[model samples]
Target: MLSRKEIVSILLLLTAMICILNAALFCNIMPIATSYEQLAQQTINAGTAYICILYALSTWVYHSNYSEPRRQIRYVLIAMLILLIAANLAGLVTVVKTLFMSDLSEAMDMRDLFSSFGYLCRTVAAVLFVITLLLLIIILIIVTITACNHSWSISSRQDSKEDLP
Candidate 1:
């Protein structure tokens, strides 16, 4: 099995890629200030990018063995992951609402290829976001448990050594 650090690195890379793609999709959809939904999507993309970068950097620090075993990095990572998941869900809901509420007759006119492409990209991004969120959650849980068990084992070993005559 891959180490926690490696898993985190991979997840962070994937998260960053997804966030970048989502940002690009939102930028192509419509002008940022044109609608509340569009503006929110842009904001979500930005926040996701920030959190992903932060978590990625933190993972490096955490795995470098320079910090205490109970560092706050894990808590921060969990919080950020939750935030990212929420933002993705919001974006997904907005996209689904737009898709359903949009006028089909106008869409069928085929006059605006960019608009159609934007919607397609948003749909694709939303699906990816869901998959990434699930992966992050699962990885986070596993990493946290592994870290806890590792720390416990180390402490127990030290205690046993101290008790040796």
Candidate 2:
């Protein structure tokens, strides 16, 4: 049976895989872009999807590690994961709509709207990813400082013992 952490890690991995798969499907099924704007939107969506994958995997690694972070930090990470999944789902829906679009002219006319939506979703995901990374860095710094202090105290105690008459 999997532990809670293992379960969470599996879920994260699955979510990441799903995001990447959706992006792959988009790439495979999408018609060649008739305009630069359309190409840019496609590139951004694909890029953001890959970034989401990276974020999910990194978070999973952190969750799997033995060094437990604070409960609040873990909660924050979970919340971010949920938000990222939501954004990816929205992107998936946008991709589907684009794929089944009936008229090339209609797609072109709506290119600006699609591009804006893509930018918004990507920005949200990127911001969350950066925030998560920052939190990880802060945790690492705290852990390093704590370890250094612990080792210093131990060494100081040893020195005092050697000095005892």
**TM-score leader:** 1
lDDT of 1 at 147: 62
Model 2 clash pairs are: none
Q: Write the per-residue lDDT of candidate 2 for residues 27-75, one digit (tens) a residue.
A: 3332455434334434544554565456446544555434234344454
Cand. 2 Cα-lDDT: 0.47
In terms of TM-score, how similar is model 1 to the real structure?
0.71
How would you encode candidate 1's per-residue C-alpha lDDT over 35-129 as one tens digit per residue?
67766766777777777776777666645554454445665666667777777788767766665545664556433434667767767766766
- Candidate 2 regions with alpha-carbon error over 4 angstroms: 31-68, 99-165
Give the range of the ten consecutive residues with the poorest summed lDDT in model 2: 22-31
RMSD, candidate 2, Å: 11.1
Best by lDDT: 1
